[model samples]
Target: MAHAKVKRLPVVDHVGMLQGIVSRADLLKVFLRDDDEIAEEVRREVVAYLFAAPVSAVRVDVRNGVVTLTGHARDTSLVPMAARLVRAVEGVVDVEFELMRSEGPAEPMAAPANGGENLSRA
Candidate 1:
């Protein structure tokens, strides 16, 4: 039906019992929502709940079902995770990230008794 561009189809089990009807409009309805609503869901579901990112750590913007995420995350790995979560949100057409990884504490450098220049500093 999808390849044929059929708008509606009936669902049945192996027994051919008419379970329900699926329509393109019904499918689309799941993915359609106001931009602000989508943004809120992304922020609540992805940033805060799924990724455990601070609500302020990531900014979510939705426009025409497209989501834009900007800000920094403590873990770089969360960047992709956040994207995936946002994509799962209903009404999200796409996701873009302008996020930076928050740097952890710097490791202390070993110093030589010779007092040589610290090449690692540069």
Candidate 2:
């Protein structure tokens, strides 16, 4: 007599706020494992694109399917552009922009008039 082989199935945790029982297959469909990797790639691509753009001082954060952008830029118009770029990413479901205009100039500091004097010296 020959014995049959048993195949193992994927396990998923369905414990959440929602009521009802969920199986491994159902959970897998609802929460795809590849989603995070895809989202991360999208985030990196968006960040690279934004950094390459003329606009400076732009930050990006991606969680789940939402992308949050917070930072200041010289041109106000660039704020919308940043949001649009993130939204265009494949895995991004939505984009939230909290970008604000820079309060003041970002010019480089000028050297002290005194020759190589330490201002912090007591």
Candidate 3:
């Protein structure tokens, strides 16, 4: 848009037919996302997938565009991975963690059917 010096851009379909128009303000609106909405995505996408219940419990808090994760994690070392995922979330300007390392070795949610005990982290 800066190179073209256009405040508004037109959207077109496959055949080059006009669909809609997008403005600079429209593209910038993503940063205006609500805090609660951002928190929910962190919980669903990052927390639920990385830290499951019973073994781990994570709390998500969002203010402005920063996200803070608190509570316990089976492997606190995964904080870097979690931060990367959380930063990928839209409207999340930054990510922070206050996770405590969960005691004991990380294990799978369910025992394998093979009848052999194995250690796993997901």
Model 2 scores what on Cα lDDT? Answer: 0.51
- Which window of 10 residues has the lowest lDDT sum in candidate 3? 113-122
Stretches off by above 4 angstroms in model 2 are: 1-44, 51-56, 103-122
TM-score of each: 0.66, 0.43, 0.66
The number of clashing residue pairs in model 3 is: 0
Model 3 C-alpha lDDT versus the unseen true structure:
0.76
lDDT of 3 by residue, 12-120 (tens): 9999999999999998887999999999877766776667554247889999989999888777777887788788778888988888977877645432233222112
Instruction: Please list all clashing residue pairs in model 1, or write none if there are none.
Output: none
Which runs in model 3 stand beyond 4 Å of their true positions?
A: 1-22, 109-122
- Return model 3's CA RMSD, one decimal: 8.4
Off by over 4 Å in 1: 1-7, 12-18, 50-54, 105-122
lDDT per residue for candidate 1 within 39-106, as digits (tens), equals: 87666556665334355866888889989988876666656666666777777789998878766732
| Candidate 3 clashes between residue pairs 3 or more apart in a chain or in different chains | none
Candidates 1 and 2 compared: the better one by lDDT is: 1
What's the candidate order when arranged by decreasing TM-score? Answer: 3, 1, 2
TM-score of candidate 3 relative to the true fold: 0.66
Say which prediction, candidate 1 or candidate 2, comes out ahead on TM-score: 1
